[model samples]
Target: MTKELLTGNTAVALGARLSGVEYVPAYPITPQTEIIERLSRWANEGAMDARVVTMESEHSMLTAAGAASVAGVRTFTATSSQGLLYGFEMLYNIAGWRAPLVLANVSRGVASPITLEPDHNDVLSARDSGFLQIHAETCQEALDSVIMAYRIAEDDKVRLPAMVNLDGFYLSYTREPVDVPEQERVAEFLPPYRPQSGYMSAKNPMSVAVVVLDGRAYSYFKYQMHLASTNALAVHEKVAGEFEKAFGRKYPAVEGYMLEDADYAIVITNSLTTTARAAVQEMRKEGKKAGLVRIRLVRPFPRQQVADMLAGKKGVAVFDQNISVGSGGILYPEILSALYHRSDRPKKVVSFIGGLGGKRVGHTEFRHMVAVTEGCVRDDSQLASVLLFTDSDWQAVKGMLRTAGKGEVSQ
Candidate 1:
């Protein structure tokens, strides 16, 4: 193995190159464009034997990927917030075709009040698109997840497309040291894509469209996708084990830090997980008994795994970088629902939303989040009150405005 300092985008491109992805049809978008740019450069230099095409739109890019996959070729592509939404229609179609491929999603908040930063909403928006999803916390995880994405997606029981999501600016552009695994080991981990040698061929006389006018037929196909997705959870774990054996790295569905004996905990995902980890360390230093759990496999949601980790805890704070407007944090409700029916579930699960549009979630916010969760545990409050309670802590900004006011209201 060779260690090199690589940005998250470059790591993703390297992963795809190692996987020997033969087709990549991409469109440029902020943050994610670097991945395409790198791959295009490699293709041009003949360092990577791949066809990197710059398409007119993300939709066209996805369409090209689907077309290639249908013809039994390995395919890959990437996009960000707006670009992902632009190709929304094709996202559904590609998965329905059972065209197994990988799409790297550099997560960005959706538009309306547009910002060129990171959020989970863009990729989570495709939750029902029959795509397996794995989110990464570091540059290394970003590269490693890409490799696992292909392996899991190509499993016979889970033959569907997949998405590897990394926060746009946080993980994508940031540089870090990553162990570049030998190509021979990667080949052993992920063999050549030889599925449907005689079936998915263009030479085969078969129709692509499924004419389903009845609800039952549509449900049948959709349910099949669901089954495949549910099966992917197990498939992902198996692949992760093999990955660890091959590269000495572990990517659990949910990674726990100091949760075993903690009274309160925090649950998070993506790059913010590093911040949460730091917070947990500080909490430990102060003897507060706080902990964190980072969600890696999001699509299958890892319900059982999450429940097992959070069951014995007294209180838990869920920090989601994406807000669902009227609904609050997107991941907050999912965590609640997963543990709600469990007998050993945490007494309180508080929701805290921060870090939208690539906003920085600093040390103060982390401390505040833990404080709120601890308070909920102390007071025996419900989820509604916890939301109101956290929301009430607006003094951070109010105090700043108060200073600018200079002891007077704004004129």
Candidate 2:
């Protein structure tokens, strides 16, 4: 193993190459394109042995990779917000077919007004689509998660597609020192893909993409897919354990820092967790028992494990990069449901939203969010679920509107 400075996307590309992937069908999409671009360049330079095919659209890209996967070889692909949605139908179909393909989805918010930035909505919107998900907080995790993704996806009990998520500009573009494992060591960790049945071969011509006759049959098959996805929870833990032994790094389903006896904490994911951790340290300096629970595996939900982590805290704030339109923070509500029936559930929990559309969420935002959570605990009050706008956020918008009106009247 050797330490090298690499961007998240570059790390991901190397992760796939090192995983012994034989096929990659993909299209270029912002924040996600670099991954495919790197692989494409490597294959062209004769450094990587893989088939990198460029398709017309994300939909075709997913279709090609999905077909290649069930044909009995390892495959990979990637996309961001709009590209992910564009290939949405094929995602469900591939999962149902139980193809063990690995995909990297660099998170980005969906567009209406249109902006390029990172958010969980692009990923969370597909939470129930029968794919295992790992949200990485650092460039190292981004690389390791992609490697682990292949192991988990190809597991017999969890023969499904897997998605490894990283924040768009945040982790995607940021450089960090990552431990690049040797290909020999990675080979020892990840086994070759060999499915039970339905492989593409002239000697064994098996029917592919057969039609299901009735709703009852479809429901039963879908339930089977659900069971396979849930099986990933245990599979992930096992893979993560072996990964550490192989690479000398540890990655759990949920990473809890200073949560053992904390009275308050923050539940967050991806790159922002770094800032939250620093914020917790500052709070600690001030004699506050603040901590952080960083989510690693989001799908399969890890509900029981997460509940165990947050149950005894006096209060906790949820940091979400994605909004659920009329509802609230997508992760916050799900977390509430997880802890609701627990005897030791926290008395107060609040949601704080920021970092959408590539907005910077730094120390100032972290301080504000932590303050709100602590105040909620002290007052024993329930706060509204969304924190979309602060007094200052609104004031700035109002100031812009005033300037626009003045210019219109002067004209």
Best by lDDT: 2
lDDT tens digits by residue: candidate 2, 128-196: 888889999999999999999999999998999999999998888889999999999899898777776
Q: What's the TM-score of every candidate structure?
A: 0.93, 0.95
Model 1: ten consecutive residues of lowest lDDT: 384-393
Give the candidate number with the greatest TM-score: 2
Question: lDDT per residue, candidate 1, 19-110, as tens digits?
Answer: 99999999999989999999999999999899988889888999999889878899999999999999999989989988889999999889
Candidate 2's error at 364, in angstroms?
Answer: 2.8
Clashes of each: 0, 0
Give candidates' CA RMSD values in order. Answer: 3.4, 2.4
Model 2: residues with Cα > 4 Å off, grouped in runs? 398-411
Q: Residue 380 deviation, candidate 2, in Å? A: 2.4
